[model samples]
Target: MNGAPSTVWFDRKRIAPNVPEDLESIDPMCEEIGKVIQLEVDQGIPRNKIIVGGFSMGGCLALHVAYRFQQEIAGVFALSSFLNDNSKVYKDLASSDCRRPPLFQCHGKVDPLVLYEWGESTKDLLIKAGVMCQFHSYPRLYHEMNKDELDKLQAWIDQTLTSS
Candidate 1:
């Protein structure tokens, strides 16, 4: 979300494999996220003490922000999200010197909106890029969050924050 709540973090007519991404809008949102990181740093929060995350489209955006713009963060947790190869994040993540933070990604096995395979592939790509990733799948879940996911996310966040 920008300064408002949203289903996806940015505007997209729809999701398709071949359509060129809307970087015209996406860049500004990423910059906004960067600003938040800077604001937190200015408040004396160490880069490693800050984490970025979200759900669905939000989850995808969080990954972009953490892996691409704010790599020094403590960690990232994405629930049912994926990224395409065209985005700047994909390019940035491919860099050899990129810092890969710990990631906790959870997906629903039967999610119809954001397919489970997409989430798995994203996690796998991050792992192959040398990101420390912890992935979880919920049986028969759709495109929504549940108590169990929240609990596990909380535990992961606590462990990450404490360890860092």
Candidate 2:
């Protein structure tokens, strides 16, 4: 499997409408991912075989893109991430008729950077939107993935790939 890493920077004050900003950055990031998906399609790969995932900011991006992409994808894997803008995301999800794939979200309970509550809230949002989400929380972990998280992630991937 090939992995792609992308970086984007934005001023927090400029983006924040409320406590949580409407992340306009997701738009360009999704466009970039869309191009990558198109490239895979051009190379004869089916869209359903493509799983979009990431850690932290990347994970947030993955969820935003997958939920709004207008196509059914394999699955989404998010670690230590949360929704950027709840109202916008909910609206997008509610209006879409595309097949919503399963989501696996892993978070560290003691994470200082991205609070554990944020992760749980994100999972709750997805679940309320009628999306299937598997959420795992680690007791003393903080802002990083552990071995147990990796194992669970692997199982989720295996199950998702096999069932799909």
- CA RMSD of all predictions: 3.5, 5.4
Model 1: which ten-residue window has the lowest total lDDT? 12-21
TM-score of 2: 0.86
Q: Model 2 Cα displacement at 125 (Å)?
A: 1.0
What is the per-residue lDDT of model 2 for residues 40-117, given as tens digits with 9 covering 90 to 100? 989998888888999987887788778887347899999988775544666788887667889999999999888888
Off by over 4 Å in 2: 1-23, 85-87
lDDT of 1 at 99: 81
Can you give the TM-score per candidate against the true fold? 0.89, 0.86
Error of 2 at 105 (Å): 0.5
